[model samples]
Target: MKLHGTVPVMLLPFRADESIDEAPFRKQVDFAIEAGAVAVCAPGFATEFYKLSDPERYWVAKTLVEQTARRVPAFVSTGCGSAHATIEFSQYAESMGADGLMVVAPKWCALGVKELTAFYEAVCRSVKIPVMLQDADFTGAGLPAKLFVELAERCPNFRFAKLEVLLPGSKCAEIIHLSGGKLQVLYGLGGVAMMDGLAHGATGMIPGSALVEVYAKIFRLYGAGQVDQARALFHRLLPYLVFALQHLELAVGIEKRVLYRRGVFPSDRLREPTLHLDNDYQKQMDELVDAVIGLVNEVKAATATRG
Candidate 1:
């Protein structure tokens, strides 16, 4: 049930008119695996959860899991506007053979921590695989440590968490302590604070900035006992990542665009309500991708020289 690692939140592939595209979806899956993703995720947000109908969401989840085929763990987000809907998604995902679920908090109702505990306990009981508590940024709501601990203790599949809060330094440690360090923590904000999170006892990262290899370099180096080297690589990769989404209205759109500009995808498509980057912003993101690609090459060269 331990779920802490660099789980890439998949970017939904859409066509020019913004409908789902299957070709690039398969490619994205292959790319992440080849790059050594610990897991591949299809969160509601990553797959444009907003616009998808319940059936659509299930179909997407089913196909993604089928395609991955146990090559990596699959975490599909199961947060809906209601606890009932969330439970539905969770149970359905488990039935579809997903290894685990990422249950985000309710956005509209904005339940308190006590309510959240009840919610998680119910959903976790409903499923057989692990569940990752995703109580991050949803209309000023956060999952406090007490509730997390309660859920982890009572819920059957409750094991991991994805902390997406914006709170500054050492706040993560506070949550860990509050949870008695029993919960497995993953940094879902990608590369930001990954090093700090690791130092504070986080198990792994779910970095969206890792469409390429620089992100992998850091994770590998850090895992292989090269702490100082990983830190330096993360710092070098950070600016390029920050720049890619700096001026974009929707960061997901920027991420997809970065992949597109690199020719990883022919069309930098986004589902409706997720607009394309403005022309100038697009150009800026292109430059950012160029830098990231360059960073990967530099690291590869450095590694080769050491060898």
Candidate 2:
């Protein structure tokens, strides 16, 4: 119920023709569970939600929820450009049995505090499930900790947040303290600041799914009081994390390639107009993964041994 630990933001698999590859997508969900993710999320930024047609979006969310089947909690990003569409999507996700909903603020145009609150409030009111506000980086909108506290007070179901701020550690700490520990915050931004998020106050993470086991290990290590070990492992993976997150759009291609190489997905295909990682970058990515993969394996071994 707390939704702590790694709830990977899933990547959608596509066939060469650009159709949703259902089989691999399902496999990817199982892969996350096998790797020890606490929950699974879809229709998020990493899922290429904007690129998906309404049917594609619905199918992906419905399939993910059905496949997850309450094995772990599943949350869907139901944010749309308007409150009406957001409510519709949120309700549909709930109908598909999503345990919770994550709504990023409406974008392309800024909303006044009152309008933004109303948008989130409308979505929150439409669902019986818990709602998490996604503080996205796409918009340059700066959400103060007070806004979250105010939303939590207004909507009883507004209990969780996915923070993607510049200074997430200090901001997370501030939100927790200001909210009297009522709001649970999860670190977004592909888990780049995961250790900082955890050390500061993040109860969980919603990172790209290419390496759930790695993040899971970090979370486990931290929780088990192995701060030094956790920090070391995090540093070990820092290179790969840095490269993959360098260009946000390009990061999607990089992650799909990682999953492809890992055999989690059949192919690393993205919709058109995507940033292509040149051969040089691809080689660097290969080397980065090679360097950090052992650390991942070692962390997995450590976790198994600890158990």
Best-matching candidate per lDDT: 2
User: How accurate locally, in lDDT, is each candidate?
Assistant: 0.73, 0.86
Q: Candidate 2's residue-wise lDDT over 1-307, tens digit each?
A: 6977998989999888899888889999999998989999988889999899988888988998998988999998888888888899999999989999989988879678888888888889898999999988633436877888988898899989898877777888888998999999998888888988988989999888888988888887899899998898788878887887777777787788788888888888898868876899878977876666666677778777988
List the pairs of residues colliding in candidate 2: none
Q: Count the backbone clashes (under 3 Å) in each candidate.
A: 1, 0
Cα TM-score of candidate 2 = 0.96
Which is the leading candidate under TM-score?
Answer: 2
Q: Write the per-residue lDDT of candidate 1 for residues 47-143, one digit (tens) a residue.
A: 6677777787887888779889999888888888877898888888888899989888776764666777787788888888998887566233356
